[model samples]
Target: MCHIASGWLYGGICRSKLRRHYSLPEAPCSDSLIHCCCRACALTQEYTELKIRGVDPSIGWKANVEKWNREGLEPPIVAPGMAR
Candidate 1:
């Protein structure tokens, strides 16, 4: 599992409002915690590009995971599992 900015999945605030958003089982924010199984799909390109650059893959993964944990960017349940 991974975490990403909600806007990346839902587009910006305008798009968020345009769609009929719904909540998840353990959503942290009632208004903005729209569940998106496609969230990881949204990050594939960026992750791959970083990998192609020979960067430490864990760096990007950890940064996004940390951000989501700190900001409650998505539902608590949607956040990445504990680091192995």
Candidate 2:
């Protein structure tokens, strides 16, 4: 179920964040289309983006929040449906 949600639902969000964080210009196409066309590349890009931002995607969300709190940094703001 988690895998399904991540692939089907969260893929676009990940790409959006990568684009926004790097200040990349809008793509000529939508993220879903990109993901559909090149899933491996899209997922790799997303993983690399998270690593570049110092977020370990392997760790669960709660651990990430705890890490942020311990470091005296606030976690990134959550979108409505993304709250865990």
Candidate 3:
């Protein structure tokens, strides 16, 4: 992505057709973007909320479900033995 951006910013130094029509500005320094800090704070808040809810934010639910199924655990029987 950075290479593509650089090519577009510098007028296609590498003869990339994709960089021809688009003009991009030089990338900003990290200090120039307030949104970077906001993203970090939002990520921290999400983890805190997950901890409060007693869920491991690191483990995805789909992966957990797949692991459980691999271990021969059936999905929850909603009606307690009703036929499918």
- Candidate 2's C-alpha runs over 4 A off are 1-10, 17-24, 74-84
lDDT of 2 by residue, 1-84 (tens): 768746734677678876776555556778877786778888897788577766788996689879999999976643233224
lDDT of each: 0.42, 0.72, 0.42
Please give me the total number of clashing residue pairs in predicted model 2. 0
Model 1 misplacement above 4 A: 1-37, 60-84
Best by lDDT: 2
- In terms of lDDT, model 3 sits at 0.42
* Residue-by-residue lDDT tens digits, candidate 1, 1-84: 234545544442433442232221222432233334344542453346445534345765567667667877752232232354
- In model 1, the worst 10-residue window by lDDT is 18-27
> Of the pair 1 and 2, which is ahead by lDDT?
2
Name every residue pair that clashes in candidate 2: none
Q: What 10-residue stretch in candidate 2 is worst by lDDT? A: 75-84
Candidate 2, residue 51: lDDT: 74
